[model samples]
Target: MRILLTNDDGFYARGLQTLWQVLAEDETFDVSTVAPENQKSATGHSITLNEPIFVTEQQKKGHKGFAVRGNPADCVKLALQGELIPRPDLVISGINNGPNLGTDVFYSGTVSAAMEGVLLGIPSIAVSLAGYNGDDYEDAARFVHHFLKQNNFIEGGLLNINIPPLPANEWKGVKFTKLGKAVYNNVFEHRLDPRGRSYFWQAGSLAPETDPETDLYALQQEYVSITPMHSDLTDYRKLKI
Candidate 1:
């Protein structure tokens, strides 16, 4: 299968490249990498608008890689619409340096990139290894690969996968989960630079609500967490209410 990979951590992120190497070695997947030229973390689904999106091609080890001057969503959108790769069979985003769970998805560029794929009628998945805790990213990549092998990508949507930071032996295996509640612990932090300029930053830890069947709990219990996501903004819950 032809797979299109993108990420929010920029084209040169350690996790992004490592994932590319693992997937590229497998004959089962024809991997293509296209990503933002720089980090676009926490950008959500924002795309380049009112401006042109730039794409520069790089061929490596007989593989195609594109560095785009835009957000993760923009890269995917442009690639699909611009006929960059004919038609990609699947879209995989991340191996992101951090977790994307519950409310955090609202601001996650990794999840957003995958959402863009789903919107374009392609099957997609977003993955993150324990940047929060300590864990084996290589093992996480294997498990995600197995999932693709097992499931036919008949269902086109985004699957958010979060791997725990524990060693593989200590992990509790995989768990299909729902988004869990996680909010900022503190409002934020503002500091002044040497030039005497003030800046505000979003700095906080995970909030304190625990749902046993949620992605958050799965991570806490050292299990690989997988949650399907989507681009549809319609609140089904709100419609019911």
Candidate 2:
């Protein structure tokens, strides 16, 4: 199988590199990487249509990689259009340095990157390791390999897997969970720069969670959270008659 790998944390991120190293070692599949040149976290599903998007070859230890001058979704978009890798059997985004749980999916470039693959009618997954300074990618990568080995993917959807940063033996095992609520108390903070210009940045803490079966609560419990997220964001249950 040919796997098209992409990530939101720029091309040089360690988490993506760890995933690259892990996936490339599997001789059962061929791997190629295409990712944003700069950080595109929380960039949603933005695609670069008007801009002249191009792909240039990058060589590392005789391995081929592509540095996309666009968002994570743009990289996948360009790849499907014959810019980077050819038609792929699967598209895997991330091994993101942080958790993408609950309402975080609404603004996640990692999930958006995977959703781009869904748009191309290919199976996709967005894998993320909890925390920013995690040194562990084994369980997450293992879970991915096992998941693909065990089941078939949904046709027009993607899976969002958030692995807690814990040793394999310490993991509470994987759970197919639902998205949790994200209550943000302080959405922004005002600050002044050296030049005395006022700017506001997104800075908020997750409020206390209410459900353990949800992704956010599961992560806090040291459980690997797997949510089969669809491209559709519709509230079908709320439709009026």
lDDT of each: 0.85, 0.84
List TM-score per model, in order: 0.92, 0.92
The local lDDT score (0 to 100) that residue 210 gets in candidate 1 is 76
Q: Compose the digit string of candidate 2's lDDT tens values, residues 1-241.
A: 7899899997778777777777777898788899998799999888887888666677666566998889898898888886556788899998898989898888999999998899889899999998877567766777777777787764647889998888878888789999998787787779999999999998778887879789988888888888987777788888964
lDDT of 1 at 62: 64
Q: Counting only residues 3 or more apart in sequence or on different chains, how many pairs clash (N, Cα, C under 3 Å) in candidate 2?
A: 0
Q: Which stretches of candidate 2 lie over 4 Å from their true place?
A: 154-156
As a whole number from 0 to 100, the lDDT of residue 126 in candidate 2 is 94
Pairs of residues clashing in candidate 2: none
For model 1 the TM-score comes to 0.92
In angstroms, how far off is 204's CA in candidate 1? 1.4
**Candidate 1 collision pairs:** 134-165
